[model samples]
Target: MPLENVHGDPIFTKINKVKKQYEYLTEDIETDVAIVGGGVTGAILGYYFSKANIHAVILEKERIAHGSTSITTSLLQYELDSNARELEEYTTLDNVITSYKLGLKALDEIEQFIKEYGNKCKYEKKDTLLYTSKEYEVKEMKEEYEIRKNAGIDVKYISEENNPFSLDLKAGVYGVNAGAQLDPYEYTHQLLDVSCNMGLKVYENTEVMEIAYGKDEVEIITSFGYKVKAKKVIIATGYNTQRFTKRNFGMKTVTYNIATKPVKSFDGWFNKILIRDNCDPYNYFRTTDDNRIIAGGEDVDFYTNIENEKLAKEKYSILLNRIKNMFPNIKDIEVDYEYCGGFISSQDNLGYIGEDPNHKNLWFCLGYGANGILFAILGGMMLSKLYKNEIDENLKLFKVDRFDK
Candidate 1:
């Protein structure tokens, strides 16, 4: 299947100065593992697999980190799409707590990577505030805060009296050191660069046209008919996984984002905390290394024609107004960048990362929802362990067919 235009003029790609290019596949290659897609997810997988001494090759249909990674907000939160109370309908509270801890573990993994390899990705650990402006939602927000606090998380409950931010808040959950932000484009390249040093091969502009499975190995044919013979295959194609599998994993939608020109000050932003509202179609706000505020939300049903400039303008306008209202005290909140991209969310608002039960030696590392980068980290660690025949109990939480059964 042909790849659709998955993103608009993503901010990260435009601002990223150092563009790294890789050669496309020219001759047939063989590896222990073949990773399809060179975005952040695939890059993370390559990093982990290469670190584990696994012979791996990454094939990207386009440029690396030029897909959904470019448009990602990179707000590393240890929270789910829904709060514990709401997610309890789809999963148990204990499972939700476990997922939160897993998110923190992923955050730690990223920090460790930065410590070992230098923080070139604008990595900064920040607090996260999940708040609600509406009076009716205060109870629900309080319930969420209590659940996290009771579960041994470092969370503080905020009410109208104790609210610290500029935004109107009836209630909020302030998670201390529970989130971080980074430059996704740079992170993807950095990961690939490090992995390449460990003998990870990456091929860009090389689309896999077909896959033929054998009893023990899989053969992937590139668009130019060059082949990749691998013992295992991993699909990290983000939201565009339908071409490889018959499973309908998640609901795909288009999420809009707008970045502001560097404001004079982040006065009322309170440590420039990563802010996420408890609204149905929630909005999230974060700051870049250059002090520009990037806010995104307002999701619509997925459409193939993502280049719809008219629709994009309308969504951008909505996002622009939201930021202005949310921080009216901050002057000159003009939009410096605006973009939209396809996103997916599962029933439990988590990612899928495990081998396909129906297809031998085939695995998926698709990280859906707002915490996709974190999920990708989890996938990289878990899948690498699986390659060594070690079983991670967390894999069951992200099993490919969890919802089906």
Candidate 2:
């Protein structure tokens, strides 16, 4: 499951191979914002802060986005936790709805950035289709459709032939304004490139060993024997911040992913996000721009005596067989990648964002199960407002102390 003290991802070594070298944090330095992790959250923070002249500096323990962001299967759809509708039970109804709506807005904002900024990464916007093959599965989709509409989201049902997947679809949920797929690496690539050009300083191999929050400025000790001073700090360190935060956010949960090699005969592959209903042990799949298909899901808690590597190979074999049954035209496509990791989850599947409860100038952006990119966007937008003193009234639900007893 989740282990904070250890090196998390096995694929990190492969990703480090093709990464572009960036500037390093050699000695003590200062900035307006000291974002301690250079994943999507940190990069997006720099992206947004650069807009209003609040230049932020990123201090990553490793290379940028080499953590959880790289291992992600990178499906950008609005489909959230099953309990999204129950958000009103714990927090204000309007803020709950706003939080959900913000996800959609964040995707749109990213799309706009891609369009305006010439899409430095491999970003392709396509129809995000959710479908089911079971005859009795149509009702749940209809229910979700109504719930999404009620939550101020633009989602509805579409006919059989109109959906994006060529699979046997009995029903569908279509988010006309959502569903985006991008190369996780390329996405990070472009974001960091643009953010740096706009004055966001970044340093690799620099870990924030300790954070000393002060009323005037924040001081952080780096693993590289450097101390940083900044007006504010964003803890986007993923599971790495577990030992540093007041709240113990990391727990056990495992998710697996596998991708198929490019298919030549399957030329008419539908260009949309696909997710099956009741396929228990859920799965999510989407087509890549280069015509390969990335499908995964088979999330389970890690258990002992189960050979992790051998079991992973077996699960991927099962996945391939299932995909072939649905799309029979494809013939023996080789598997390109196999990845599995735990979601650095939260108690309510709602991220802990905004300022630290105890520290005035220290802020954090964390995720539950979903909302990696979505939460990053929300944090960027809210941080923008915070910089301008125009804070949203709906942000308190994501407070760090929501679970205090």
Worst 10 residues of 1 by lDDT: 1-10
Tell me the spans in candidate 1 whose CA falls farther than 4 Å from its real position: 1-5, 304-308
- For every model shown, the clashing-pair count is 0, 0
Tell me the TM-score of each prediction against the true structure: 0.97, 0.87
lDDT of 2 by residue, 217-324 (tens): 899888877889998888887656754775776444556666777777563355445454446556777766666677766766644412377776777777777677
For residues 1-405, what per-residue lDDT tens digits would candidate 1 score against the true structure?
Answer: 213645556789888885688999999989999999999999999999999999999999998988888889999999999888788789999999999999999999999999999998999999999999999998898888888888899999899998778888899999999999999999999999899999999999999888899999999999999999999999999988767998998888889999988888887788899999987789999998898999998887786536577888998998888888888788888998888888888988899999998887899999999999999999999999999999999899999999886
In model 2, pairs of residues that clash are: none
Candidate 2: 10-residue stretch with minimal lDDT: 3-12
Model 2, residue 303: distance off in Å is: 7.6
Pairs with steric clashes in candidate 1: none
Leading candidate by lDDT? 1
